[model samples]
Target: MDRIVVQAAAFDAGAEIASLREHDASVGAVAAFVGQVRDLNGAQGVDVLELEHYPGMTEASLAAIVADAHARWSLRGVTVIHRVGPLKPCDPIVLVAVASAHRGEAFQACEFVMDFLKTEAPFWKKETADGVSRWVEARERDDIAKQRWQGAGADEATQDKATHDKATHDKATEGTRARPRRA
Candidate 1:
């Protein structure tokens, strides 16, 4: 897994995918997606989009997400890039690619990686359009959506819930087995 930034330079998504597949002979498939700045966003027509992130923290967050994908899926390679700074319309904003031994894992891991990047990574968007520049917020739904990624390794709350459930289930099973049939 690798994460990078090209500053003002544009990235080739296809080139990134090729690099991932070229390294491993076992890679049977590669899935990738690129997001770009659009000319219009709903009521507002986009002029330019600026992305910002806390330098070291941004990279760390993204690297952790890729690592999570490796742990969750049998992935061969993953590459991600989320541009920072001003981007014109049609300029690429983000790139994600996944390679695996099978197409299923490749596709699913690609989606998983992209989704996690959207919600988990701390990238802020400032869209200057419709004569307004506003900061984007992580939607309430974004919070709820990201909760699905909260694995047992993520927090004590989830681990605690699993432990509690396990203990309750074990006790119930033991009690049921210990009770003889009433016949």
Candidate 2:
């Protein structure tokens, strides 16, 4: 089973992992990653983080990423949850969990999902610190991480689709940045 969610609500990591393992008896190892809103980005103290995305497009992109993982590894189960809206420091941002018969596949799939999510997803983030807000730029490190997976698990066709999807998304959301709602 594969579950993908994009919401403004927070998620329970333990419950997600438990649910992933509960339905499958063959799952011998479960690997998970929880990303939280940090209090600081380098020296700047972060007060709030806001994430936004195109509703239908974001979910479709995530499904493609999960499907690619399934194509690459023998995963028993996978769950991905990414939160949006205004978030405070220390708030949970995303969760990626994978269940497999062995540890290696589970670990690799979990990492692959996260790496793809960071670079390929349509999410936009803005960080506010000292009452000033700035949209977070795409990180070179994340692009590098995503590049390493090329030609690893997915074949040329799958890779081409991923590239096409990313290009389409970038074109669609070219100049848009999520703005904070005034209170």
| Best-matching candidate per lDDT | 2
How many clashes (backbone N, Cα, C below 3 Å) per candidate? 0, 0
- Model 1 scores a TM of 0.73
Q: Cα lDDT of model 1 overall?
A: 0.73
Q: Which candidate has the top score in TM-score? A: 2
lDDT of 1 by residue, 45-144 (tens): 6587888878888788878877877876677788888888999888998988888775655665677677777886778888898778988767777666
Error of 2 at 48 (Å): 0.8
Instruction: For model 1, state the Cα shift of residue 55 in Å.
Output: 0.2
Per-candidate alpha-carbon RMSD to the true structure: 10.9, 13.8
Candidate models: Cα lDDT each: 0.73, 0.84
